[model samples]
Target: MKPRLAPYLFVTPAMTLLLAFGVLPILVALLVSLTDMNLGGLADYSRVSFVGADNYRELFGDAAFWQALGNTGVFAVLGVPAVIVVSLVIALLLDRGDSRLFRALRAFYFVPAITGIVAVSLVWGYLYNTQFGLFNHLLSLVGVAPVQWLGDPVLVKFSVALVAVWRGTGLNVIIFLAALQGIPREYREAAAIDGASELRTTVSIVVPLLRFAIFFVAITTIIAWLQFFDEPFVLTKGGPLGASTSISLFLYQKGFSASQFGYASAGTVVLFAIIAVVTLVQLRARRIDAED
Candidate 1:
């Protein structure tokens, strides 16, 4: 092969895979969203009539869809910041401590991230059980009434969000800890010499330096929270009047349960557009931060 074409040849395999698995599926889904293509319609191509923007219109007018979107927004809005702060605190603590026991404790905290979501959900479900759960048992000790966790529509979103935060926070903690460890000790020492307190140094120096890692965690957490499915599906199944239903779970139910492939495709496309826009915004923010 010519030297000029060697670089292209090296990248050809990855490009081919991207087109086949990524680009092609997105294009197909876009086309499918323009038609009435259910399972039956897939079997009989003649029934797959073009519907233009009808599917998108139907999704827009869907109350359940809107509810799911709202729930997802609540999940992201509440869960993202909570997770980021909690993870950063843990990371900072782990970075400061220098004992073997602390290192072991850090590993214990990260165990949940490696655990399967379904397994964690199942465990959490038992813990959230109204009658015999650990949480209610603890509440009983405080003389507080046992709240219906998954049963109440108002509490269901919060319940699921808590479970998601618990399960997902560990990974963010690990990410932030790695970033904290990467910061030089000299900066902290210099700040201390200048009469800066630990809190002030952390706020003014450590945080600003970790902006890239923070931005990365925020963007990834947003994307992951948008696609939240396993916790809600396993725990509530979007139950208690659909309070915990997420956009991804809604897509799954519509596509598989209702067999509305085209409508699901439209939802998926919308989700893709939302994620793409958010990612671009994060990238621009990162660029501006770097320039500063």
Candidate 2:
């Protein structure tokens, strides 16, 4: 076989799938965003009208859109850092544990990540229950009032963010654990010889070495939180007056509940832009830090 032909043959299947599933849907969505398409249009091709930027323009004035956007921003900002820091800390502890027991514990920490979101939500929902929940039960033992977990708007934001933290930290734990294990022991030993304390060694050696893994986890966490849906949708359904409503859930409401496909598609494009800008900003910051 010719060298060039073999290379193409190896990539042909993956490239074909990438274009078919990834690029194709994006192109179709972009086209749909320009038109005023809905359920009526689904039945008749002629019903879909080219509204141009009307849907996008309308979004700027939509109160729900802005609220949902704010909720999503809060989740991403708060949850992403919490996940990264907690996971890294746990990974560091587990890395030091280095025994059969710790190995088993590592597997235990990962259970939440593998569990279905609905199952996690149901369990947490019951825990957050006012009458029979374990959390309030514990608070009662401490002589504290049963604070509304999902009822009050302030509590609802934190209530859902807590569940997100629980579900998300597991995967990052695994990633950071692996990265921790991969770091050369000689680097730490050299640091020790140079009179570096444990904290100094961690700050100077371990963290810099784990930069790539940290960056990867940070980016993925931000993207995931920006699209956070299942937790808020299942737990509160973006409820108690849209307190925990996220961009993804709002998009779901627009596309499926209201059958406003074009409007939802326009929201999708805006969301895409938001994610792109945020990711780019992080990349720029990372680059600047690297330069410094």
- Which stretch of 10 consecutive residues in model 1 shows the poorest summed lDDT? 89-98
Residue-level lDDT for 157 in candidate 1: 85
User: lDDT of each prediction vs. the true structure?
Assistant: 0.92, 0.93
Pairs in steric clash, model 1: none
The CA lDDT at 132 in model 1 is 91
Residue 76's lDDT within candidate 2 is 83
Winning candidate number (lDDT): 2
Deviation in angstroms for 34 in model 1? Answer: 0.9
Q: Alpha carbon lDDT of residue 226, candidate 2?
A: 92
Tell me the tens digit of each residue's lDDT in model 2 across 1-292: 9887998999999999999998898888889999999999999989999999999999888999999999998888789889999999888888887789999989988999999988898899899999889999999998999988999997899899999999999999999988998999999999999999988999889989999899999999999999999898999999889999999999999999999999999999899889899999999989998898
What stretches of model 2 exceed 4 Å from their correct place? 290-292
For residue 194, give model 2's deviation from the true position in Å: 3.2
lDDT (Cα, 0-100) at 128 in candidate 2: 99
Name the lDDT of candidate 2.
0.93
- Candidate 2 Cα deviation (angstroms), residue 4: 3.2
